[model samples]
Target: MTAWVRGRVQGVGFRWWTRARALELGLTGWAANLRDGRVEVVAEGPRESCEKLLAALRGGDTPGEVEGVVERWSDAKRSMVGFVEK
Candidate 1:
């Protein structure tokens, strides 16, 4: 599944936080900053792993404040080589 997260998701180590969680959960995906001050996440993995990713993205163990989250399920067609910041 893929998610397009918005709100104060930039300049606050949001990408790095996501990268760590994705790696820890063995998820394959890419996360980057959007020009519109939002964060874009494309991830694929086991169903459980994807759930964990969603939880983290929605506010897991991270110290940052996640005011809100916008989630969407996609085709999972994209293959992630590595988690990156863009």
Candidate 2:
């Protein structure tokens, strides 16, 4: 799944937070900051895990405030080795 998280998402360790959360959930993909001041995350793993990540993103912790989350689901590609911040 790919998600674009909006609102106070940049410059606040949001990418690192996402990496940690995804790693904790044993997911593999990457998270990056977009030029439009959003965070783009791509993760692949168990469906449940991905959903959990999405939920966590919605309930963003300190240093970030998640105003909205736009998600797109696709066929899981086990190509990613580990979670990364880009």
Candidate 3:
């Protein structure tokens, strides 16, 4: 899963929170801050777990305001190790 999150996400521990959520979901990937003020979250795991993360992202329980979340689904590559904030 690749999700681009927008709105009040930078400099507010969004990446850290995302990493924690991903790790708790047993996912492996990275959440990175884009230069354009968006956070790009990439996770590799079971479909169910990914969906849970997505739900959490849009569930309005995060540190910053998540105006929107645009997600893309794809085949897992099995290349990621642990979740990290990037």
Candidate 4:
């Protein structure tokens, strides 16, 4: 699953947050900041894993509040690389 997340996500360690959570869930993908002040995430794994990642991205059991989450499927190739901020 993929997400084009907006709102007050940038400059708040959103990418770092996602990397940590994704690693915890054993997910593989990339999360980066868009030029338009949004966060673009590309994730791949089992459906359950993807859902968990999305849920965490939306609003995890953390202090950061996710203002909004826009999820969608994408044709991007899955990364065999480790999670990292980009």
TM-score winner: 3
- Candidate 2, superposed: residue stretches over 4 Å from native: none
TM-score for each candidate, following the candidate numbering: 0.83, 0.95, 0.98, 0.84
Clashing residue pairs, candidate 2? none
Model 3, position 65, has a per-residue lDDT of: 96
lDDT of each: 0.78, 0.92, 0.95, 0.79
TM-score quality measure for candidate 3: 0.98
Clashes of 2: 0
| TM-score between candidate 4 and the true structure | 0.84
Per-residue error (Å), model 4, residue 73:
2.0
Q: Per-residue alpha-carbon lDDT of model 3 for 1-86, expressed as tens digits?
A: 99999999999999999999999999999999999999999999999999999999999998889999999999999998999888
On the 0 to 100 scale, the lDDT of residue 67 in model 2 is 91
After TM-score superposition, the amount by which residue 16's alpha carbon in candidate 2 deviates from its true location, in angstroms, is: 0.3
Question: Which 10 consecutive residues of model 3 have the lowest summed lDDT?
Answer: 56-65
Instruction: Answer with 2 or 3, whichever has the higher TM-score.
Output: 3
User: Model 1 clash pairs?
Assistant: none
Which scores better on TM-score, 1 or 3?
3
Error of 4 at 53 (Å): 0.9
In model 4, what lDDT does residue 23 have? 86
Question: Under the 3 Å rule for N, CA and C atoms, how many clashes does model 4 have?
Answer: 0
lDDT of 1 by residue, 1-86 (tens): 77777767788888888888888988888888889877888778877888888888776455456666777776666556767777
